[model samples]
Target: MSFTIYLRCFNGIVLREALRFVHQKERFFSALVRPLVWLGIFAAGFRSVLGVSIIPPYETYIPYEVYIAPGLIAMIQLFNGMQSSLSMVYDREMGSMKTMLVSPIPRWFLLISKLLAGVFVSILQVYAFLVIASLWDIIPPISGYITILPALIISGLMLGSLGMFLSSAIKQLENFAGVMNFVIFPMFFASSALYPLWKIEETSEWLYYVCFYNPFTYAVESIRFSLYSQINIEYSIGIVIFTFIFLFLSILGYDPGRGNLQKKGGK
Candidate 1:
């Protein structure tokens, strides 16, 4: 009975998110544009200069655009997460969050449903980006597409949970746009998303450690490995750990008894 209720709640939340996505047509293209622009501009500039090592799983030398494609895929998920988090902030301000909190479901279940909804929306945007990349001749192995599905879901949920936790932590903020700017860009750029960890390490030891420690790096590397039909064991484990940590933080922050949500002037 509890499982049934949870399933129904999950379905309803995903449906609502899907409907919202259908209405926001601009968001679809906007998600696509951001990465493509980065890919186009960076690939054009760095194609000749950056030498990609013969990394395991990636059999041969690949073009710069192809190398960054997984990162861009992860990028779309990261931005989608921030947007979803912003929506949560808006919901709280509008009093809708109160209604959600008052529901019969467990708060953790609600959080999971919310995370899944965001993941679903983000995955749709990801495939659209992939389709465009393929059209641009940045194709992957056809099997890679099949294998990437699970990777996308795991990566999407990790990023979405991080955003959700961030929203809950800053529940008092009248404007959460700053979180979007401050959180998203740093996580994206500081990771293995754009450049190899080795390359970044060569430039700065501290920065390499930053990238290594960044959960986003694991998320991106996990996706990159999946794209080539290989599993990055260490990074994959890192993503799971980070996801659970963020999930626990999210649950705590939204708990009014323990968290800032119901406290006046709390951060």
Candidate 2:
């Protein structure tokens, strides 16, 4: 009811999510493995063929590994977001979600708390990846590391909100895997994550358009620019806009009075 109560609610939610992440060692490792594999193996293989031209974020020609590093970071946040949604669906089936939803705190606050909790976990994963990448010589400027935090936060929220909205459409935990694959793969591959938008354009115009419109592309670009201590205002604004849009949809979907919660027979 008061400010302190709201603070405690947020702290409790964040702490719970952090503890869950700490206990799930496999979750941490799995999150790193996918991006690491691409960084170590795939990036190495393509280093010669995929030489990157000077982009706004980079003042000079850079290696393929360097160019894709931000994309991999975005990938970590993207997967972390979906993982959060999977937990939401799990909680729903276990009936724990209903208890939280019925609490005195506002529903939107509760959902945003959960979203922030997931973002906290995601920032951890992204930093861990950065540490490993640095060891492998993919380091950015020291200042770049500091400047990138805000970008990561915005990107994480947008992706996590998307996952929350997707969870509302999924009635069962089992169906999530299929849906995740359908969404994740296309979002990753179609975006400018692995290749530059220009390269995609050279290959196919329609695919280039897909990359142009994908929010994930903006997420990656925002990170890429931020890591170099530059702000891609256009991409950053796009990410913020999508974050709000997805957050609104997630709040709508989780509303017991009018959202998917009602369809699920939630009280």
Candidate 3:
């Protein structure tokens, strides 16, 4: 494709998703509320449980809210990524996705543009959450905020691609919502989002291993390390590998004559 045409198509997809985001103000608030509830309520309960101890990402004793902040940020991206996929499924059902799919633009380019739009919105929501967290005096270093961007971008892409792969298999809106319960909650809970892996290990060895291996764990860990103005090379590498693999699977899942959505559309 010509450079101009590619840019045109990319911008169109991104602009549409941006407009959709703006129109749905509730999504922003909803994303904020879920994490804030955890920070305010769940963390309050856990605060006494963990009892002002040192954590890996913190040099000194920190509040539970501070400790869980990165996990909550990951939670925001997780939900937003699923929201993007839900929108994709809606678009497919409405025939708009099919229209885009049949366009002369490369499928990979279309998919990448769509995922970028989703990641863009996710990053915005996460930063907004950070601002709110700061208001509650759960502030990280100013530089940590800046340093966390790359982590957030990589994490968003990983989650968004997983969502896209999911949308491809979900033929209807009801089915998509139902299926997300199996994926999203398990991912958030089974990861370090709520509790440390060692904590889980103290309870169930298998569950600890599950959390250790979860891609979402690395997502949370990357953000956790970044929020401390450091980096987790293992988490960063895991996210890179997961993003590429999921992106490839999502592309295959969206293919005509072979994938689930196309098969349902054929029916």
Q: Tell me, by TM-score, which candidate is best.
A: 2
Best-to-worst lDDT order? 2, 3, 1
Q: What ordering of candidates by TM-score runs from best to worst?
A: 2, 3, 1
User: All candidates' lDDT scores?
Assistant: 0.86, 0.92, 0.88
Candidate 2 Cα misplacement greater than 4 A, ranges: none
Residue-level lDDT tens digits of model 3 in 1-267? 689999999999999989988999998899889999999899988888775456677899777788789999999998988889998888887878888898988898999999999999999999889888887788888899899999999999999999999988786788876866799889998998877777788899999999998999999999999987998788899999999999999999987757776478532
Model 2 per-residue lDDT tens digits across residues 7-88? 9999999999999999999999999999999999999998888767887778888888998999999999999999999989
| lDDT (Cα, tens digit) per residue for candidate 1, span 1-267 | 578888888898889999989999998889889999988888879889998887766788888888888889999999898789888887887777778888988998898998999999998888888888886688878998888888989988899999888888774556576786788889888998878999998999999999999988888998898987889889888889999999899899888688768664432
Instruction: List the candidate 3 regions with Cα displacement exceeding 4 Å.
Output: none
lDDT of 3: 0.88
Candidate 3 TM-score, true structure as reference: 0.96
TM-score quality measure for candidate 2: 0.97
Compute each candidate's TM-score over C-alphas.
0.95, 0.97, 0.96
Scored against the true structure, residue 109 in model 2 reaches a CA lDDT of 99
